[model samples]
Target: MQLPVEIPGLLNYWIVIVLMMVGFFVVISHGNLVKKIVGLNVFQVSVFVLYITMSKIDGGAAPILDDAIKNYSNPLPHVLILTAIVVGVATTALGLALIVRIRDAYGTIEDDEITNQERDDA
Candidate 1:
């Protein structure tokens, strides 16, 4: 029986999954706050790739309506992704701001060290 995610046709999906796993690993395993943010961005990029891949239709043209073009790729996904990109930028900025604050307060961005310091203080 043929699986839905065959290796030949779904290489992009496989790549995305691998990227997600790498990102997830970095986020979970790394103690540095900056590394976690980089991992999160990687994960976000993989999701964006998945969405774009899913929205693509074979032989589909841009969403311009024309008599000659039968298949038109859905623009909604692209639009939503654009909004997500904006939100992602804002979120990243906020995260950086928080990181700066955390660094100022704790003098370190490593999660383990910060927690250890907190424990010593408290």
Candidate 2:
């Protein structure tokens, strides 16, 4: 049967939505610090994919001065994504380091357990 809209054209968007939801679910449903970090990374990746997908152009060429190249895709999105990747890596490293410190101090990485310990201490 013919569908209402073209599926192939929007397939990338569907994938991005699915990935975004999965990442969000993982972050919301899990209590483990590492798991949360993983979820965040998944979410970050989905966003990166979204940006890249949106920046794509049909029959587009690199931004270069050429008379034959009438259509030139914007390079800003790619550059921004590259910067974001570096920032994401640094942020992940910092997050993991903080988690390590939290584990050492609380003796657990689970959020509920840490809260319980704090409650008991207080």
- How do the residues 1-122 of candidate 2 rate in per-residue lDDT, one tens digit apiece? 23476547678899999999999899899999999999988989898888887886766688889998888778889999999999889989999999999999999999999999999999
Q: Which stretches of candidate 2 lie over 4 Å from their true place?
A: 1-7
**Candidate 1 structure quality by residue, lDDT tens digits, 1-122:** 22465446688899899999999899899999989988888888888878888887766688877898788788888888888888878877888899999999999999999999999999
**Model 1: lDDT of residue 60:** 68
Q: Candidate 1: where is the Cα deviation over 4 Å?
A: 1-8
Clashing pairs counted in every model? 0, 0
Q: All candidates' TM-scores?
A: 0.87, 0.84
**TM-score, cand. 1 vs. native:** 0.87
lDDT of each: 0.86, 0.88
Pairs that collide, model 1: none
lDDT of 2: 0.88
